[model samples]
Target: MNKNIVLKAENINKYFRVPTLFHVLKDISFEIEKGEFVSIMGKSGCGKSTLLYILSTMDTDYNGALFLDGEDLSHKSADQLAFIRNQHIGFIFQFHYLLQEFTVLENVMLPAKKLGIKSLEEIEHDAIEKLRLLGIADQAKKLSMRISGGQKQRVAIARALINKPSIIMGDEPTGNLDSKNSEIVFSILKELSEEEKLSLLVVTHDIDFAKKTNRIIEMEDGRIIS
Candidate 1:
């Protein structure tokens, strides 16, 4: 494995037993390098989202060897995988999963707080800094329910970044936003990959969004088509 590679999946295959076996993913093999912004594009049920889930360590029943940041994750225990996920991978879903009752700063600090590697005060400071970097510092004191849709998404990004994970994985991160806000979110992600040297892997249906990424891995019928 190259030292510059941030994630690598070798010979990945997945099957679901609905009644009989249904193949969900073919033998997928790929590598994402550090500071790279990559997109996975495919129609619904094409296995793009399934692939993302497997790479994120959320689905381990599939046959594959998964590596992140030079660590092989083939047989790690659930607790070990959880720690690796918190410390090495940040995830953003289509919907902003912020706790509506929690203030923005508190939402962002949740991951770091759970990791328990830093003091509450230190995590609070770092969370604020992440929100500031995402240009939502003014909303830090507001409850999540009080913010706008785009603001909430940015807050999710802030939460993802609080731990400074080696890679950020987003599944339709901008799917729920309008075009204007979608562009804003895309630009911010691009900037983070380029300027901050973060590795990003996004699963998006928006063709325009896919075009903006460094590379696109297109899948069809559970196989890489391009």
Candidate 2:
């Protein structure tokens, strides 16, 4: 494995037991290098999301191996996978999934707290710093519910970065935002991948967004088409 490769999937295959064991993925293999911004694009039910899940180490019932930063994670236990996900993989979803009742800062600090490597004050400081990096520091003290959709998404990004994971995996990260907001989110993600040397693996249906990434992995009928 290359030292720069943050994620690699080999000969991956998945099937649904229902409906007579329909296949959902076919010999998927790909690598995402450190600091690279990559996008996975396909229509609905094309298995892009399923592939993302496997890469994120959230789906363990696949037929192939997965490696993350030189570690073979294909057969890790559930507890081990949970720890790996929290410590190494960051996730951003189509919905921001912010805790509406919590302040933006608190929401961002949640993961760090769960990781329990830092004091509350240290976590708060880091959370504020992440928010500042996202240009949303001013909203830190505000309740998550009080912010606009775009601001909420930014908060989610801050939360994702709190652990400083090696890879950030996003499933339709900009799917719910307007064009203006989508562009804003996209730019932020790109900057993080470039300036911060963060790796990003995103699944999106937006061709425009996919086109702007460093590489676009296209899928069709559960197989890589390009």
Candidate 3:
């Protein structure tokens, strides 16, 4: 494993047994380097999201190897994988998934609190700092539901950054936003990769968005075609 490789998947395969044992992924192998920004582009049901889930260590019912930061994670226990995810992987999705009842600051702090490695005060400070970085610090005290959709997505990005994970994975993060908001989010992600040296792997159907990334992994019938 290269020291600079933040994530690697070798000969990975997945199957769905409930629906007559359909193969969802086949020989999916790829590597994402530290500070690299990559995007996965594919048609619907091409298993791009499934591959991302496996890489993120959220789906372990697959064959082959998954390595994160040079550590093989193929056989870790569920609890162990959970801990690893909290500490090493950050995720964003098409929807923000913010808890409407919680304040923006609290929403951003939840993952750090779950890790239980920092004092509440320290976690709060870090959460605020992340919010500030996303330019949503002023919304910290407001309820998550009070913010607009664009702000909500920014809040989700802040929450993802609070843990400072080795890699950030997004599943159509800009899919739910308007063009302006989508561009705003994309610029933020690009800046994070350039300035913060963060590793980002995003799955998107938007070809324009995919074109802006460092590399684009195209998939068809569960295999990387290019």
lDDT of 3 by residue, 1-226 (tens): 6899999999999999995989999998989998899999999999999999899898899999999999999989999999999998999999999999999999999999999999999999999999889998999999999999999999999999988999999999999999999999999999999999999999999999999999999999999999
Off by over 4 Å in 1: none
How high is the CA lDDT of each candidate model?
0.95, 0.94, 0.95
Q: Model 2: runs farther than 4 Å from truth? A: none
Position 157, candidate 1: lDDT: 96
| CA lDDT, candidate 2, residue 166 | 98
Q: How close is candidate 3 to the true structure, as a TM-score?
A: 0.99
Off by over 4 Å in 3: none
Please write out the lDDT profile of model 2 over residues 1-226, one tens digit for every residue: 7999999999999999986989999999989999999999888999999888888888898999999999999888999999889989998999999999999999999999999889999999999999999999999889999999999989999999999999999999999999999999999999999999999999998999999999999999999999
Model 3, C-alpha of 122: deviation from truth (Å):
0.5
Give a tens-digit lDDT track for model 1, residues 1-226: 7999999999999999989999999999999999999999988999999999999998889998999988899999999999999999999999999999999999999999999999999999999999999999999999999999999999999999999999999999999999999999999999999999999999999999999899999999999998
Pick out the ten consecutive residues of candidate 2 with the lowest summed lDDT: 50-59
Order of candidates by lDDT, top first?
A: 1, 3, 2
Lowest-scoring 10 consecutive residues by lDDT in candidate 3?
A: 19-28
